[model samples]
Target: GWARLADDPKALARLPTVAPGATEELDLHLSLETRLAEATAGETLTHGDLYPFNVLLTPDRVVVVDWPHAWIGPAHADLVMLLSSVALSGIDPEPFAVRHPLLTGVEPEAVDVLISAQAGFLLAIACSVDSTADPRLVRMMTELGRSSLRWLSTRTRSSGRSKSKG
Candidate 1:
């Protein structure tokens, strides 16, 4: 589930080079911390980790595994992580979206926002895990962060432009 995110043209176009100690990581972490704190304060559900590897599929049903990263927060956060991981595996998220609409809720844009934030947090964590030794993880985190930043930047710019026009 790391292929599509790594291969997406738009995502790649916006990808930034791997630069440890950069401002982008700092901003991303700050934003994530804010969301995490808010989620912790309010009503929220946890997932630990919902990657494909942890999902056990049978002919009749599917079961999710793992329970380390689990935390109470907005359900959208978990959904975003699941969908993003699916997308990364070069799979179409639309099918999953259709099957489990409740997982994502009504706001598609919010899904994007959540995914961007999750990616940033994940990237930061990945960077801290021996980034110098694992070039692949380092690259993945760098790209993910860049993609998240680009998406956030676009959202901000669009919102600003709309406000100006109003």
Candidate 2:
């Protein structure tokens, strides 16, 4: 479902208007579908939801508990989700995310696509007229969507990557 919306050109194009202040994200969508096709094609079982609530800490090692959204996607997808949850706490997690052992050797564009996809999907849900979702749920989606876009903006700018609309 999220992937469908993410790869839709109409959905990507609507992101700027759906997410306030996300106009610059319009440029970030360049090649997103192509890159995602490669990055997300993997055998790894990423959690798809890796927030603290689903994680456990043991003296010996860390553990992940949730599996409902698990998928055969890039390992870095979980890392991106983890970092996104961290960002919601008002802390910037990019610096640590980039160098984290999990994301080691992962392409920069791979990470960018996940952020873009999630941002687009989340914002779309919040803006959807058919959404009978609660106001609180809608608000949460909107906040997380905006947060994801901000994270994307920071990552793209730091990497000196931006595509001008053709």
Candidate 3:
């Protein structure tokens, strides 16, 4: 269940520092503990951890390798993950995400919650005190966390600056 991805209280605390205006909207959705399972229910089979490292593209076809994070959930989940990674690479994913078929049909608030959950998860990771972890990894997580929050803020405020692809 997506409920397993609940925000850690400490990470939740850090959100106001990340984006003050977005948290009230985030908190409203996050507080609905029962909605996640219902919201994510879908026939689409999604690779819950779909990032670039798990995908390989050859001259002919694309291959997805990792399966550990695979799950049956909303079609938007994997795309959102990928677009979030796109943000980490310094691209603005909003232009693509707003027009994407999968995301366009999803409730905007639902997507916001997923983005917030990721922001929470990644920021919590950035806060972890494992001395052996690479400095680069910690830095990447912090950057990704901040980017996701910014994206969520943009989404929550404008219903996205980009119009639907329809």
Candidate 2 residue lDDT tens string, 18-62: 676665544445457456677688888888767777899999998
* Alpha-carbon local distance difference test for all models: 0.52, 0.72, 0.67
- The per-residue C-alpha lDDT of model 3 at residue 57 equals 98
- Those runs of model 1 whose alpha carbons end farther than 4 Å from true positions after fitting are 1-16, 19-35, 39-44, 90-100, 103-113, 131-166
Worst 10 residues of 2 by lDDT: 25-34
Q: Rank by lDDT, highest first.
A: 2, 3, 1
> After superposition, which runs of candidate 2 have C-alpha atoms over 4 Å from their true positions?
1-18, 56-66, 129-131
Ten contiguous residues minimizing lDDT sum, candidate 1: 157-166
Q: What TM-score would every model get versus the actual structure?
A: 0.54, 0.77, 0.73
Which ranges in model 3 have alpha carbons more than 4 Å from their true place? 1-34, 160-166
Best by TM-score: 2
With a 3 Å backbone cut-off (N, CA, C), the pairs that clash in candidate 1 are 1-88, 1-89, 4-88, 44-73, 48-69, 48-70
lDDT (10s digit) by residue, model 1, range 1-24:
122324444433333434333343
Error of 1 at 165 (Å): 15
